[model samples]
Target chain A: MRPSSAERASSGSFELFAWLFMRISGVILLGMAVFHLFYMHFVFGVERMNFNTIGARWQNPLWRVFDFFLLAFALFHGFNGLRVVLDDYLSQRPGWRVLAKTLVFVLVVGLMSIGGYVIFTFPAAANLAAVP
Target chain B: MKAHFKIKRFNPEKDREPHWEEYELEVEPTERVLDALQTIKWEQDGTLTLRRSCAHGICGSDAMVINGKNRLACKTLIKDLGSHITVEPLRGLPVIKDLIIDFTDFFAKYRSIKPYFINDEPPPDVERRQSPRQRARFDDTTKCILCGICTTACPVFWADSRYLGPAAIVQAHRFLFDSRDQGAEERLPVLSAHGGVWKCRTVFNCTDACPQGIDVTGAIAEVKKLLLFRKL
Candidate 1:
């Protein structure tokens, strides 16, 4: 007896999920990126931003949440976009694709980790005051 | 000047076999390949079929394989090639007729990337401010004429039609690098999916066949760097 169609289709959901993820992530980034620009560039003028300004913002739990969202969304968005381009052009050689996506995942994960850590353990304003 | 041209012909409705038809033409050395083709169609054989419009390279209407490489017939000069030339429709695309390939799949892939600036907020009444240097960053990628040369030359797309290909990637790169474009965050993950930028093998054939000399591999590399590093 031949194997059922459902069995074959179920095995390929990983690829289907990847495609669906692109559409979903692409939509989410559309909104998050807009909000990000509004907060960073328009809400407070670019000239007014500095280390202290960022430090102050990071001190707030709400802003920390904002930063985390930004980091995650931006990294995923950028990575997924590159993934599409790579798949389109590099599908012939499995070895090359594996090596390239591995590097990409590593770099995105590293940046996300650093950004997340900075947001999480931000130095308190009192610490800055005590230094002087 | 006398020139010899060999063209691949296959008429599915009439002929069961694919064959090459030869024609001789008298033309100036500086004349383009399109000119010779025109001579053959008008003087020697009316049955010959091909697609063309702008006659200039801009429309990307006359892309074909010339002398074993993909190129725009309108832009290639007889002086640059030997007296003998072979012309055929671009490889890797479904041939709809003589020298015309089905572009529906190609355009669909291009559209999948959402190749437009997506700023949900209303635009400012005044011009959006961007420094000249910011504009310069993406200027090279903006020159793509949607010519299928890069996509057809790509081995990845050759095997899998679902892959978005280089021309679309270059288009994505244009918006990805643009300062005014607010969709980078959304565009990236979509581009990074299964048939996305992850598939590029970097053979550099697209770079060689590009008439505008855009660094396609370099742009793909830049996209990879941005995706990996999460920043420029």
Candidate 2:
């Protein structure tokens, strides 16, 4: 392998983007989380958060989009933090690292699909009850 | 006592690829890993080649991959390593032959950090006086003896040989915190360049690999913190 210092520094945008993502998304997630907590706890109050209120809010696609971004960002931040551990320990074993990464990818895909389906198809309960 | 050693060997002049050779040997409980290698080279086989200087761990010349960890052969007791030992050249650099590795890239990175005391002041009759507290600032880093174990064991350096590895950061820390040195400001941007302190993933592999027990990771963190606050 060509061991030039100049080449590798320029070839590392993936790592650069990952580093920037953590810091920027952390700031964004903090604001979003604070706004969410205020809306849930102070503005609406805990007692008012019944299924009716949540279901009414879920009727808006904007709310779904908001929750989607929150889930995506939070998951990315937490998983990228876990990547530090994997990079340290698992990289020593190439085969194990590959398996670990594949499992993590599958888990993220499954969780995102399930969460998106639940948020978008809330009214599917009505169709289930009338099917019989 | 007896221990099994599996050493990675490659003779570039004769062999096309590297391979491992296993040897069973008798040893004393207090014998260092360097003594074990000496036995192998003197009695078992003369073709084995490795580097060792002080044989007491002070010279830092005998650092190698032992049991998948970077350590000084003269410091590691055979008893502490258990009955099995896997010896190999330090990773991340090209191996020259047997257990010796080419340290050109490692030393180049160290040089990039300017691992020397630098001052532009005119000399007085006496030496540059340093307070006890001022000397303590970079004390942990001063113990480094230019061993490439930390740099070679680094997985980031293994992935991209270009990245200035942890040893370079420790050297930078030494000069960066020196009260008599007038090069901290100059060294700051040099370290902050393309493959600077930002590349550290904080795996702490460097900290783990240091034979001198220096907190290499902590020094790198302090450097990264300087990037924001610009303090000593």
Candidate 3:
């Protein structure tokens, strides 16, 4: 009924979604990361890991899609975590905190764009180094 | 048994900063820390000051740092703390005197949460009754005594004063879950704001610090869930 209460009510759901995103993305990242690690490091082995080996795997398209999701989730999750840390540490400085968060947002967008492009568009054809 | 107490004392009129004073007294293991303090005030140092009433855990006025943990001086027995005990005022609050901190900000935060029943309907001739199960919904949070221990114990509260703090959230939980209360819509927004429930990092210090054994972290989590889903 009061002005303060009304203002608070009109506040966006950004914090709510951010909190939810952390938990959801964390669970997803954990599952995808563990699978990728085990499959790549244990099953595929580090000895034979070269550009051709990745090329052969990405040729299937499933791994490309899987790796893309992994890249996006990991970046978002890790940066969001850094955002929280920034929030905690820079709480005293409102202007600097806003600047830090904006920079982080730009950095995440840039990293995601580059990573996504590589995962989706990298050549799957055998090139200079074939594992065979 | 002999008990040695190291109490943090400060007098703005005389001292520039808080200093620890040690007192040695013969005490029984079953005797409470409040008993030792009383003895010190009565027999040893009449200037020793602390806030206490009821001489039991019910009042929650005796909440202070007992050996690095938030606890009621009345509830803490000499046996548990052994012969040596360290006492200090609750952290993150301005101390007015020895073992007494300013509670102005603390109570302001609590009041902001709007702790109390809010129901506007034609009253029944009998009473606004609730099922036992309905009452059980907010049973844990009903025990809050506004002790300020949970809030003071919270690291988030210590780091940032803007946070609503754990005690306030627990109070909000009490009314929010009540079947009769219609204040959730109002309370949820206040909590979802910048310094609201989202600031809780799930640290269990509030739960650990509650003298009434209320699951403070659990209550906050429940409020977060309620805000997310607006149900249960």
**CAPRI-style quality class for the chain A–B interface of candidate 2:** incorrect
List model 1 lDDT by residue over B34-84, tens digit each: 999988989988878888999999999899999999999999999999899
Tens-digit per-residue lDDT, B1-232, candidate 3: 9899999999989999899999999999999999999999999999999999998789889999999999999998899989999999999888999999998888787878789898888789998899999999999999999899999999887877778899889999999999989887777777888678998998899998899999999999999998889621
| DockQ of candidate model 2 | 0.10
| Position A80, candidate 1: lDDT | 77
Off by over 4 Å in 3: A1-11, A126-132
Interface residue Cα RMSD of candidate 1 after superposition: 10.3
On TM-score, who's better, 2 or 3? 3
Residue B64, model 2, lDDT: 91
lDDT of 1 at A51: 77
lDDT of 2 by residue, B1-232 (tens): 9889999999999999899999999999799999999999999999999998878878888989999888999999998989999999898888899999998877877777777888888987999999999999999999998879888877777765546888888999988888899888667665665466766878888888788889999998888777646532
Name the candidate that leads on lDDT. 3
lDDT of each residue in A16-72, candidate 1, tens digit only: 455446667778878878888888899987999987777777667898897798789
Candidate 1 residue spans exceeding 4 A from truth: A1-132
Each model's number of backbone clashes? 29, 0, 0
- In the predicted model 2, the residue pairs found to clash are none
Which candidate gets the maximum DockQ versus the true structure? 3
Candidate 3 per-residue C-alpha lDDT over A27-100 given as tens digits, one digit per residue, 9 for 90 to 100: 99889999998988999999999877788788889888999999899989888888877877786787998899
